[model samples]
Target: MVDTNETHVIVGAGLAGAKAAETLRSEGFTGRVILLGDEREKPYERPGLSKKFLTGAEERDALRVHDPSWYTAHEVELHLGQPVTALDREAKEVRLGDGTAIRYQKLLLATGSSPRPLRVPGADLAGVHYLRRLPHAERLRAVLRNLGRENGQLLIVGAGWIGLEVAAAARGYGAEVTVVEPQPTPLYGVLGPELGGFFADLHRDRGVSFQLGASITEVVGQDGMVLAALTDTGEELPAHAMLIGIGAAPDTALAEAAGLEIAPREEGGGVAVDASLRTADPDVFAAGDLASAYHPVFGRRLRVEHWANALNGGPAAARAMLGREVVYDRLPYFFSDQYDLGMEYSGYAAPGEYAQVVIRGDAGKREFIAFWLDGENRVLAGMNVNVWDVTDPIQRLVRSRRPVDPERLADPGVPLDALPG
Candidate 1:
């Protein structure tokens, strides 16, 4: 039930969309809120798509963002399975796929992102998969749940976060896994060489095979089933199943159509948002993975696809959308549960910008913290993995924004506080 004056339109019903609606209600926004998603099913948690959900360790209930009854109780007019095709910025109306025009007082573009496709030939073969939505995880889960429906080995394309997580899950199911990555080390483009090598070692120790600096020439299949993936080295490996986890691109066609300005990343293709999460067009606000929001700590645009940003960035953006003054600048945080280890982060680490890197513990056996310093040489980002409880001091460093003594940073006896952010 959309009231004429009580309407707020939100596009893309993933994390950002759902969180925006919840935030609006919590803020006493008793207006009509419309939630739209291109996906056919109700909103669900996506981080588990690569791990627990992919391996059948978790059920669909655990993957949902909200229950079916939750939306109705909040009076949100959710249009699941219906994607917004266009935005008439001047008229302040959204054009749905089925020719319905919905008007709104405030428009939130949470149109998230889509899985980047594998460019090699035969990428559309029946066995090649990409993990994004629930259906994708379900299909990939079917392969791991019942090997009888499949055969041979699992060939993974790209050694990214999702790719590696999927590899770990597949190996757990007793499938022979071979990861194909064109880079010398995985995640080197973002996390840097040393950290990438560290991840490579972790995977190798877990019985996963890797083919570094190898390119896929093509994927050969018969009757929709993948048969083999031919590599540039002229070697063909038989693959019963294949998974592509290269990356994701911002779904910004609607934004661009609405004449909103988009910020460009060094790597490419994400829209720009201000410190307040508002687009150049004052009437439109954006957040989540699609918007390259500014980071005061790092002094550059930060666009993170992790759940924390998608969940928190929304309410922050909503506050601004309602003409309330609020800052969305929380230290970026995200986590991943791989094997038996819990990996977490709270800041950025520019590859060469860190004047100093503080390592609290040994990197070999886990339990370590990597802190990055700025050009003025103050703290900018903290990359902590396996630290049971050390984030409090790191958060202090981030707030104090100071540098620590070099010798103390390397010393185990000294508290991390002796060092500065």
Candidate 2:
């Protein structure tokens, strides 16, 4: 039943695009599968870049999603270092930077996001860095190693996940780390002040300094190399290197240029798509960080930048493209490992969306599950820190959308599965 004459093209050869190609062939698609990427390297997962890779505990080869031979063996037309420059919707073709126009019967845009650049003075200095690609991590690893030996200081602007993870990695290298954030606490926008304070304390105990409620006004450098960072609070923090980790913005240029509907910034900004991950053009689909997909459960559009989204969304879009019924309602999930603490979070709840955050177990010991609830005590999100095997029940609790007794929800003696959802 496969269409032998059809050709499917996937752009941005990241985790999502690579997986989509694998899924198409695995699902018995005999059509031509072309995967394009701007980077010359093979597809790789990104989570390790900030954790094990940066800490020098993992090798580069471990990051690859598939071996180099896998693509050849699977008959996937792998195209690396070929950036897609333009898309012609009417002609059903994508123009590459090399002037090659590849026609497709179906198209998928898996273009991932890029780190938001720091526009402060001296940002272009040699010692100021940003981590988004494999090369960036490789360079940062070397820089940290050299800085550690010289007893240098690392000034990290932004206390988000990447910044904090890099702080932990820098500390592993014996480098002095100081994190500056405009927010009152680390991870304020995601975990809110309650749990954000926990992270601040956690990092402080690990010999990391914090300049909370502050922003870097300028990057001071000497001889085209970073020397220090000046804060808006009129403080100059001495540093041999600086890292800007504010956040990332989705890559949607190809889809946007092709006249695809894009979501507003307030709606999580990306290429807008329905629950099936299909854009208005029908033949074109968007996935991974580039997709602002309609979530059936949340009743809203969500554009997640986590590794899990790309790991799962690609195959979902592949199946949908193959004419299968698909509904992408996966809960927003993410995990972090900073020092000895490892945590997994499920569901979505912005700061104003939840009325109360109830905790089970001892938060002081970093062994607990925190639940964000609405006024009716309905679970909106749950995060388990240093805990294991509770993701299933926690996801069910959020999906149930039912109220539970706060006291019981916080009781360690009560089984989470036994509780009323």
Candidate 3:
């Protein structure tokens, strides 16, 4: 057990780090808690960036994960804007950017992630942007609004979650938008072709054009401002602004220098941790987007980049640090909102792991729940799109891992809770 006066240092002031600090205090640990962040702002919810926050439906202050008073009242020391520069594992101390060394009894690295940089020729142009931080979202919102006013064209370089949501938001703002994806369908890796194609249709119906199975050779620009993107197919897609939302790379430079185990990049690279969320060094822990923990539920090492994972993993890591027996076994959960569609997914399944997909309600109607099942008829994962109050039942179906009747699973008249075991 950690001594009451022992200082617990948490790196990264995102949701996971904040939640971990909250857990430590709530669990009666009277230790000194220091939360460090490189960002200027305090912990805030990021999911709103692409939807509510960017669309001007939510205020900036409301996006904060916790008010400043909470940290003060809880006696949690927050070091914002100043990033840690070095980790001296031997001395159990971290050096800040200004060369101040702070010692700690235990350390938690939650140094989230940064948006993957676009490598095209004109990617550095003034009008080209990527969404990851509040400032980026704010700038993109302003850009989209300007485009809407002038009826300018908006070009998206990815069809992933950020790309699609921004497309939806841009369309709502009256910008003529075009999304270009190398994949044949949007979200193909996650939802597979059938469902991904449904999303493509959904976007197409909303006046968003897609250049599927297309690759950009270069971003065309003039006066250091992006004007269009040249496709490998010899087509020049005109644009007033471009947003690249391919994906994010885990922020692991600190962990790497400290000699923590790192996972393979293809496997969602991050600091490697055991089932208990502890690194090779017992005094150190990792969580959030930067820690790829061994997931017992999925029976594999998985790194999840979703809000729910960070929310649940933070407390789990904190409990483990306090010498509590903890296994981060929660099924990964994530949700996305696009136009009229809102979706919640639970459980884990690689692209090709689940063979059969059973759907209830009409996909064309945009209100339905779909279940991905393994060969033995066990539900592997499930998602409810534009459906209300069914996530609990869907999650239960995935957790049970029992054979479910395909017919019943696809029948809207049959209740999910009453489905056969």
Candidate 4:
């Protein structure tokens, strides 16, 4: 039976919070649903911030997860620009930044994450940028357009997905981009050294320069405008602007203050939750990037900051909050677009977790499937680059947790489904 008197509050009006509210309504929860956000903008997806929106291929309106009227029509109380400042578990209420307090029977923290800031000198200069919110993207878009016209140089710190995507977007606008990464190769942490060279070459072919195995020590600027970046390798790279894309840390301040358990940094730190997405506090739950949720299949806690995680995690958490069974065993999945290459990676295989990487098709052509396997040749993760309709089989292979012959795994003629999972 639905309790119309009960009120459910969701903090952080990103994709996760928005979807959670929608799910509550769709699941016949005839209760008060309040979605609060720190940003004035309505709930929106982040994937476009680094992709189409950055390149001017898509407008800002297109990034919104739902139309403004949807919230009103669904009776979901949407509060914009009002961040929750405190969570009072005993009182069952959340205090807003303006000192407004709202009571709730249940709470969901979909606070998402923030980009890690560059700690180097002059990092606070006017031209230094980071891509996380809508405002950041707007500023970056303008900067890229202006730089492209002037043929200005853009120095990017870190070679992760955001850095490389921005590199491709800047290149699209004809801006000179130089990526400085401490790792030996681009995407070394995710793809590892085996396939990182492929991404390095992809960016290089399109006029992008890379400062591999080096870190930026200082940002040189005059009059609050960035002029160049000095690397630890003793090389000063010229730049009109700089982008810091090292990584993101979960926004867990509210959860922490409320005494929620947090996972260790090595376990992908965030508010720790069980398989059902419920935190140590039964009435409280965490989802999206703010959640380090226990995965039943993987038998470990994982905090994924991808679009898919927010897209699916939100709904899963909503169901769990409604007392439905939710294991949240969805395999880790993410996709990236850079230049002409589009790729989707499924499953998780951190460095040292997989012993072998098997490739089917041509890596040079960038149309291939790369599989990460354990010592027993069990599929751990698989990435399909410029390949279509293979996600199902790839996910099945990883889920099967069975060993397959390495040679067959690499053979193009061997049907993936035919192989022993």
Looking at model 2, report the run of 10 residues with the lowest lDDT sum: 1-10
Give the Å error, residue 245, model 3.
0.5
TM-scores of the models, in the given order?
Answer: 0.94, 0.98, 0.97, 0.99
In candidate 2, stretches whose alpha carbon ends up further than 4 angstroms from where it belongs are 1-4
What's the lDDT of the predicted structure labeled candidate 3? 0.90
Question: What is the per-residue lDDT of model 3 for residues 181-277, given as tens digits with 9 covering 90 to 100?
Answer: 9988999888888789989999999999999999888998888888899998788999999999888899999999989889987568999999999
**Separate clash counts for every candidate:** 9, 0, 0, 0
lDDT of each: 0.81, 0.93, 0.90, 0.94
Question: Residue pairs in steric clash, candidate 2?
Answer: none
Q: How would the candidate models be sorted by TM-score, starting from the highest? A: 4, 2, 3, 1
Winning candidate number (lDDT): 4
Query: Model 1 over residues 1-421: C-alpha lDDT tens digits?
Result: 3345767888989988898988988887878899999888888778989877887788989978888899999888899889899899888899999999998889899989898888878988998988899988889888865553443488998888888898888877877788888888877665767678888888888888888889888999998889889999777978888998888999888998777877765724667888888888787888888988887766678788888888898889888878899777778777777777677777766576566666768887787877676666566666677776777777677767766665576576888756654
Which runs of model 1 end up more than 4 angstroms from their true locations? Answer: 1-3, 147-151, 355-357, 374-377
Error at 117, model 1, angstroms: 0.8
Q: CA shift at 214, candidate 1, in angstroms? A: 1.8
The candidate 4 region of ten consecutive residues with least summed lDDT is 1-10
lDDT of 4 by residue, 1-421 (tens): 3455899999989999999999999998998999999999999999999999999999999999999899989999999999899999999999999999999998999999999988978899889999999999999999999999999999999999999999999999999999999999999999899989999999999999999999989998999899999999999999999999999999988899888999999778999999889999999999999999998767899999999999999999999889998888899999999999999999999887889899999998899999999998999999999998999999999999899999999999999989886
